[model samples]
Target: MAMIVFYEKPGCMNNTRQKQLLAQSGHDVVALDIRAQGWSPETLRPFFHGVPVAEWFNRAAPRIKSGAVVPEAMAAAEALAEMCLDPLLIRRPLMESGGRRMAGFDEEAVNAWIGLTPVSEPISETCPRSDGMCSVPGRGN
Candidate 1:
């Protein structure tokens, strides 16, 4: 089984579920708090390799929702700088295993990377909360 390094926001329900699915699939999950990590552009950028700059961001973040940060409008360098300053702007469950890294949880993508046990329900990247926001620590529900 692969040892996956999972960066996540504490108290995020979706993150918890993702970790559970990984474990149930027999992978070893090393969960870390994404907000606590001291991320640099070079370090964080690799997780989003081949993906669009806009996809690197967490759409549920208050800054994005409030129109303070527009992912699609920012350049790569600018986007990286912003995300490093506020990890909340980065997407949830940044996963790295076997030298390959990816942002967000796409069940099919993850299964293709590492085997996943079939599940009845669909796993989604978007927050299931009614407000379309995650209850992050120091931020309210």
Candidate 2:
């Protein structure tokens, strides 16, 4: 079993589900609140290595959803700066294990990196609260 440092937004449903999956798969999950982290460009950049700058953002973040922060329009340095100032802009469940890191949860990628139990239900990376029915009060997806 691997020890994964999982950075997440507290009380997020998708993050909760993702953590449950990792635990059930026999991996040790160390959950941390993403918003509480002291983020800097150097520290945050590694998690998004090789990923397009636009993909570094949390599409469900209020700023992104409101069209205020357009990931596609921002450069790498700019994106990182914005994310540092507002960690909610960073993607959910940034995970690190075995010296490798990943930003978002892709079932196939995760299963290939660290084995996962065969699941019948589909897992979604997007926040469920976006539709206004998730557990976190007053937070939109």
The number of the candidate with the highest lDDT is 1
Per-model TM values vs. the true structure: 0.92, 0.92
Q: After superposition, how far is residue 107 of candidate 1 from its true place, in Å?
A: 0.7
lDDT of 1 at 95: 97
Runs with alpha carbons beyond 4 Å of true place in candidate 2: 131-141
- Deviation in angstroms for 51 in model 1? 0.3
What are the per-residue Cα lDDT tens digits for candidate 1 across 60-108? 8889988999999999999999999999899888999999999999999
Error of 2 at 94 (Å): 0.4
Looking at candidate 2, the ten consecutive residues that score lowest on lDDT are 132-141
Question: Each candidate: how many clashes?
Answer: 0, 2
Candidate 1 weakest ten by summed lDDT: 132-141
lDDT of each: 0.90, 0.88
